[model samples]
Target chain A: MSHVSSSPKVRGGRKAAVGNVGRPPVAWALPGILFFALFAIVPLAIAVYLSFCHWDGLNSPTSAGTANWTRLFKDPEFRQAAWLSLLLTTISWVFQTPVALLLGVWAAGRQRSRAVLSAIFFVPLLLSTTAIAMLFHALLDPNFGVIKEIGPWFGIDPNIMGSSTGALLTVAFVGGWQFMPFHTLIYQGGTRQIPQVLYQAAEIDGAGMFRQFFHITLPQLRNTITTSSVLMIVGSLTYFDTVLIMTKGGPGTDTTILPYLMYRTGFQTYDLGYAAAIATALVVVATAISLILVRFSGFGNMRSTREGM
Target chain B: MSIDTRPVTRPARPLNRTRPAGAARRRRWGNPLAGLGSLVWLVLVIVPLYTLVSSSLMHQDEALNGDPLAFPTNPTLENYRTVLDSGFFTMLSNTAIVAVATTAIVLVLSIPVAYVAVRTRSRLSGLAFRTFLLGVAIPAQAVIVPLYLLISKMGLYDSLPAIILPTAAFAMPVAVLILSGTMRDVSEEMYEAMALDGASPLRMLWQLAIPMSKAGISTVAIYTALQAWNGFLFPLILTQSEENRVLTLGLFNFMSQFGVNIPAILAAIVLSVVPIFAVYLVARKALVNGLMGVGGK
Candidate 1:
């Protein structure tokens, strides 16, 4: 009786309590921890060290102390990328949040009618970054692209993703476009989770669609709404693929955001030290943004809830 | 892009007062506006695809100046044949090996780790959990130079393994994050019964964790494949020879060699996109369901 109960109970409890207080490692947890440590942790530490020294990403190495960091602090390109990242992040967050909310609310009440359209729009998100870039690339081509093809009609002969103002705006728009499915999905999930009975009660109170969103839907989806914003914020800072494939920070470096600059510094210039410093700054920015959003949304409390798991 | 600007409220028609008056109006009102809005977006996404495929079929003359919206005047498979015959097979195989190998490693490495992150209870496990999050934040571009150096020094540059390892490393965090969420949903009662039946911990994980998280695992697997196959940076920076080119770099190579054979390029893209798109079509619901959770929290 004693042997039978204790071993099973303790094992079960440990399984239920992964990463929790005062418990043993579960059966499979050990190997998981090892792979992550070897692949994730070691490489990260090595990267941080490599950032401080002049290695050329080849040869032996020489220490640079704070020289790399200091150079990054004063570099014009670095400043531009940082500034651009901030601008894009602000624009995406401010714009996408409201539009996403509106789309989410609009889609909720009309399911069957929106089904085919949902699939069409959803295609972009499921696709390769290669494809999305290609679609816009063809459309935005300076000579005879679709947008250019149609631009004269609107009397707008602008380089939508080629000019500086257009570059960030286009990036923001692309970012917004690919990500709207995610927002719609989360809102769909969260709103569905809100019991139908509640909506019936709200209708009896003469609540309209707009009021329903603010009073019922928004409050209910507070968790997801905040999560979507935080994810977008982080994503905008780390936006790389679109910039790489389309702009390459081109049209005379007009679209150089932080990740693009890091790519340029590290790969193009072989400045390992400076690249690392830039990478560190990016990490700092990403972490700070996450923490800020977490603090604002109270997701940090998830640590406490996670403890219960 | 038309928006359905339907009236949010009606003149307080008494509930159940007029069956035909309200019911008839409601159906007519929402359907067309909703249908019209979606059509605009549908055309937005579909037109390029239509052009891309149609352009490949048309001769160069018809391609550059023909009606952009019309079906190909003389649809042809020559472009498809061009890509398939012109060392395209090698590039296709190269892409397959890199993408398939990366997917295998990520699945093998992350599944056990995800299970641990869900089932273990240790400070070290907690450290590992947070460590995976680093894979997400560190823009891989930051480490490309060192990675290139590292791969090149190890005599792996231009080798398929060079791209495979780094891609898997970058993707592992998200994979684990997704898998752990799926694994956590597997109840402890199920695991307890297995332990009671004298199953080893290894067996328990195989039977319980892996089996339960199948949907989540597959979704993550498909996504990882898509990411690796479409990876442009690694193969671009690491590979040097035409022999080493994956599909993505192959496109760039074709661009350099014979100019952007837009028809051939589009045909190749069509080929590349269809397999993954087919995979998505089959698994669309599972993917969306998985992402709602994965992205939500």
Candidate 2:
């Protein structure tokens, strides 16, 4: 009020008054800052610290130097989990992205059918991961699960969850199933953003549906594809709840991913230091990949512009 | 790019041209193929959900030993009764509290932060927004050990806040990203007019920003609620008691204890999903749009 009243006397006062009018953006941002600092930043810093120390929950830490890091690199379980995580990430890219693109294209063309299909497909995503895992677990039960009895006729192992490779692949497929709708929506939004004129022009040039799709639609969806891939990669690497519920990294660590490995090493083994090292590595890898995606793929710039829409 | 380079031998096509007789015949074939494709997808989508619902209604023995695909001739509430009787309601209540609290806090905290990030030119808000973006890439699994230690040290262990706070924290980056994006869509003239009418910044936000960004708010609210509701890691690590168990952990125990009781397990799964499904139905559009924002980010 004082700044406003004095603003008429000087130009600088008006600037200061505007800056201090009722409140600046910073005032509104304070709670979020504090919250993020405590929960996000502080815990992250502590995890980094814990990674360097050999501390159990029961006792104070002693410095382990890089022993935890050395062990993390050498631990076959960790290696297996890391490989599985990578596999899941790659499989999602190879499989889910295209499937999502196809679904998105299909959805964009037909509104009513899209609505019904979307409602059906997105159910897995909306339901808890634990619930989805449990649902699949039951559906694949060895004796009476519908899939179990039916799979053998099609040359699929009825008890796929009992084997290591089968378990990993099944979980990956489930992860794709759960998240494809999300990617579909992203691609659908991208498809919508294409100007109708481009398609009309293509039609006049004697381009059929396939040609139009291959040339214009595919090219226009590039950014959306990049964004969804980055998300799927990060999401797959961090996949936990479903895997934990369904297999508990069972059939001898086949389905274990980095996150589940970290959880098991930390909670079950009570080796917080080792687990923290894995955690630190997971963070580093995830952050590095995300940075690469944001930088090389132009995700960061593309997102803000797309989101602003 | 290819449109302009077509062969000269080909005649210029009529715009909005009608299909030739042969093309029309092909179209007749294509429609059935398209229908079949859609039907295949629909079946793929519905099969699992149908299994969940159907298995829940079946007799336990039949679900486990007989044909699991068959509809129950005698659909019973016995499985639901078994689940509910075994403290399902308590877990539901606990989940409700956590989800609602997390959503409320996220919406309240994110709105102003987003508003400021969108509306202001302040370096502080800009820095704050950048910091929030960093949170998006930080996986919760990477920090769970530290979170577990922190919660215990702060004496919040085995409590709902222990779970709620971290879940909400994990949710903030996306929430703020979404809300700020939404808030930026409001016209600047509206803000200026409100200010010219003797409105304070807060007043301007309330009158001009909030209403305009209601869709974004709903999206954030649903997303945060969904996260908190489906959260497993936080509650798994932070809380120890059955008293503190959210629906995820509760259903988990149901699975472990009643592993062979297919009906009971399905019943619990169905119970756990109902609330979230209800929310999804109500906010289906916002949820899709919200996820689109997430992917866009």
Candidate 3:
């Protein structure tokens, strides 16, 4: 393992001889920076700017002058959407984390069946969100879907998509089904990184498998959990495709999370300015969560987790 | 320093001797609860996938009438034929173009950025890296309204470039993060050695950095390609024409177009995944590592 801490000293000693000879100039990053700025940063600014204006998306946007912002605070629909987004994020995290964590730890074993099962488990991640949504949509179709045939045995209603709670849960479940494998992979990677010595020592102390997992695996996976949770939270916040394809935020806005609400206001309603407000709000929440993640993970410093090892 | 790469050549002799036989036995039989949980999840995963494939092969009447869990006694490829005939190839081609173009653009733009960030000590490079670090938080959906405006104003709406440009832009932060993480692993001594031979920065980037960071590059390529292939919101909001419809949008349209034709819709879903499934089969390790890279180390 290379010691990143000693690199500055090495560079200082070689400063007179090499003198940044092989170092790429800062200009090398300009194209990327400019391109990213034009698309990402500029649009972010535009979203915020548009939030304060009223435009139907045809003529120049006229100043709404906090009209959208004030209405946003008063709008029950926005409140519901924000609530639904939070609910979905919470449900998805709860549903996915334990299942993924356990599966990840189990898959980290060297058993042959575990490897094959892991591959099978990864199948969902390969399919597009649209494809997965459509698949579930068909399977859940009240009249013609498979759910009509098998739902009773499990006490699930065939009309799950048409009911409010069911629709939200369906959205959450589908999102979980699609993303659980990715999170599982994260945990699997984290589990493997736990030193074998720790487990061995725990076993020598007569700790059971569950005890070892709780004491050793869970604590070791703290950084991994934070990383996955931030991604999951941000991902659920912006989930659009599945809702668009499956429910269209239907059952009377039951599943209209923030992104879907933003889509409807911006595109379907043609209230682009109001939609931009919703979008801006989402950006703030997502950025705040990410900043917290970066601060907690020390990711902003580009520090490797393996540094002290 | 390839994000997922670890030493695989550790000598096994001493470790094997020290390893407890009970440890190996315990690993196999240790967690019946976890095994049971995995079994339940297996069924959860398999049922829908089974429905996907089995229902696709059944006739529409059979799919609606027959038991969903039952194997089709009269399986057929007619549903596949229906999907193939309904512009599936067009959407497939369009998606392929988007994926390839997005991957290419992301690579061209991000490689230099990552290279400079890793090799240079300038404050500007650090600022550039920090910009991307924050950029990772900006959800693509948050910018769709403005992107639509920008794409329309640029006269690129309803075109592949509209989808390509923004998709690549959104993919930049993760691409740069993964690439720089890998690039930073190129030992300083290697660069010093190249400098002693009078290698320029550009030459070193092309000859040394690029070759050594192949894992990261492939990961970025696969990541961006998957992003473009699976992207729905960009094409949905930015593009308006059938010719511009990518696979995800195509599948979304198929949901309504093949309404009540459950077999055909399932067939479309199956066909859409075949390309990626092929990639997964061929390069599972690289793809898994690439995906793991998304969560960082």
The collision pairs in model 1 are A18-B120, A29-B116, A32-B113
Q: Give the CAPRI class of candidate 1.
A: acceptable
Each model's DockQ score: 0.26, 0.33, 0.53
Which residue pairs in candidate 2 collide? none
The C-alpha RMSD in Å for every predicted model, in order, reads 7.0, 8.0, 3.5
lDDT of 3 by residue, A25-135 (tens): 889899999999999999999999999999998999999999999999999999999999989989998999999988988877656677788889999999999999999
Name the best candidate (by DockQ): 3
Clash list (residue pairs), candidate 3: none
- Superposition TM-score, candidate 3 onto the true structure: 0.93
TM-score, model 1 to reference:
0.83
Q: Kindly indicate the candidate among 1 and 3 with the higher DockQ.
A: 3
Model 1 chain B lDDT-worst window of ten: B3-12
Fnat of each prediction? 0.27, 0.55, 0.66
Worst 10 residues of 3 chain B by lDDT: B1-10
Ranking by DockQ: 3, 2, 1
Off by over 4 Å in 1: A1-27, A98-110, A298-309, B1-40, B193-199, B258-260
